[model samples]
Target: MRTIVQQGTRCTALAGYVRPDTLDSALAARAKGLRVAAGCTDLFAAVRGPALSGGILDITAIPELRAISETPEHWRLGATATWSDIRLAPLPPAFDGLKAAARELGAAQVQNAGTLGGNLVNASPAADGAPCLLTLEAEVELASRRGTRRLALGDFLTGPRQTALAEDELLTAVLVPKSAAAGHGAFLKLGARRFLVISIAMAAARLDLDGGRVRHAALAVGACSATARRLPAAEAALAGARADAGLAAAITADLVVPGLSPIDDLRASADYRAAAAVTLLRRAVAGLCTGREAAA
Candidate 1:
């Protein structure tokens, strides 16, 4: 590996940068302890204070790691698929919440550079994408020199800024099953202001209705727990409810109280987040029922 030095910046003693064209090369480099860089939208900001002391493995050039494809069973979103790609893809209505999150991730430039896999691996509690992915029953695909593995999105995230990825493994893809693609989805986020602010509380909902009655429901909330979580109790309550504006009343705050563990942060108090989550949940469910946009 080569050594690098940034002359004018606080970051000094920077290490080598490797851009591999193949997944095999990327995995081999990672196995040797090089820090992986896909879009580097988050990496550059994270390492700005201290110089990168080790080798850098840039995986953006790997062709197989950048495509979004769908199979008979699932939709496969490659690790390097940008938020812009997600917004423009011909996805089903069940992915509407995810698409909405993608549009709200950041400015247009960040959307062009930020990636879905990077977002998941960062594992921030307020990540705009997680709640939508959870409601869609997303899965993560991890690859290493040894082999590959898959884990439920909910299980992959352990806590704030932590994930189940092994050091040598790379998150190669995110998978959404075909069965979960039949529902209508809605996303709602509450922030101090509009555009470009972190969420105080956010909720995503997917509902599959049969003859104006809910056949299946999935509800997830973020920024109020260690990881974004599905409210099984609330989903259970809405399973057979009528798909009308009145459905919002059935989603009482008490049903969601058990799933949240919000903390008092600078953006909002714990109590306020809990209340906002319930309100967002109600709005999301109602939006799905009425075919209206829920996020602002």
Candidate 2:
């Protein structure tokens, strides 16, 4: 086993590792199959999992991959932006809620070092960032020798630890549309402990209000399904409706969709995850209400 450490942080020296500073250079270097490593948070699993299967394309030095910009049409986050970056950003409600989730990802050190792109690439069922990004209608940019393409974050992630990203592509950026930027949103996670624990269930929601009634809404639940999913029934129920305990309860019940396919794991029972996901859904909606009222 070989090891590599930079600035007191542990990384791996795999069979082949290439560090490139530009998008084109990174893409070129990745023409041959290679695993992407930004923060190296999840790369440990790749290095030690089972086999020395592939090379490494280290994109940490790519300047274009570290940008966070706000435009009239969207809030663009570089794939490499750390959880701490999102947490501290002065973003609108949609992203503010995600920032809250980022803060819960781990401890301060993890928040400072773990990258958003890494989370998306890892595509964990319990990833704190996925549900919120799904609700935001975020898009991910994938670059390779073939050129660049974009897809919704939900579409990019096919299943647990699986993504549409190819072996030679690097995730460049995450784009949150302006509509998502202005909407009121919140995220909630239920874990064994408040901090440093994988979520048993989590929910993220965004509400667009018109004259004190929700005109549009998006709701997604994580850890209760194969992938995080938007509660379309719940969203429809909340749309054009006044937010209240009654509405919250109805939405919560409707959130138990069939597609999630949650199974009993060591963390919790299937039934428990399903039930808890609904509770977190309600709380997430309530938090949005609070955020809206605070803004008002």
Best by lDDT: 1
Clashes of each: 0, 1
lDDT of 2 by residue, 255-276 (tens): 4656466668899998888788
Report per-prediction Cα RMSD to one decimal. Answer: 6.9, 5.5
Error of 2 at 242 (Å): 1.0
Error of 1 at 252 (Å): 1.3
Model 1, 1-296: lDDT tens digits are: 11111111111223488787777978988999988777788888888534666778777777677788888888888888889988988888999999999988888998988888898998889989999999989999999999999999999999999999999999999998999988788888888777787888999999988888899999999998889999999999989888888998888878997788887888889899989999999988888877733321
lDDT of 2 at 267: 93
Please list all clashing residue pairs in model 1, or write none if there are none.
none
Candidate 2 runs further than 4 Å off: 1-15, 294-296
TM-scores of the candidates in the order shown:
0.92, 0.90
Model 1 RMSD in Å is 6.9
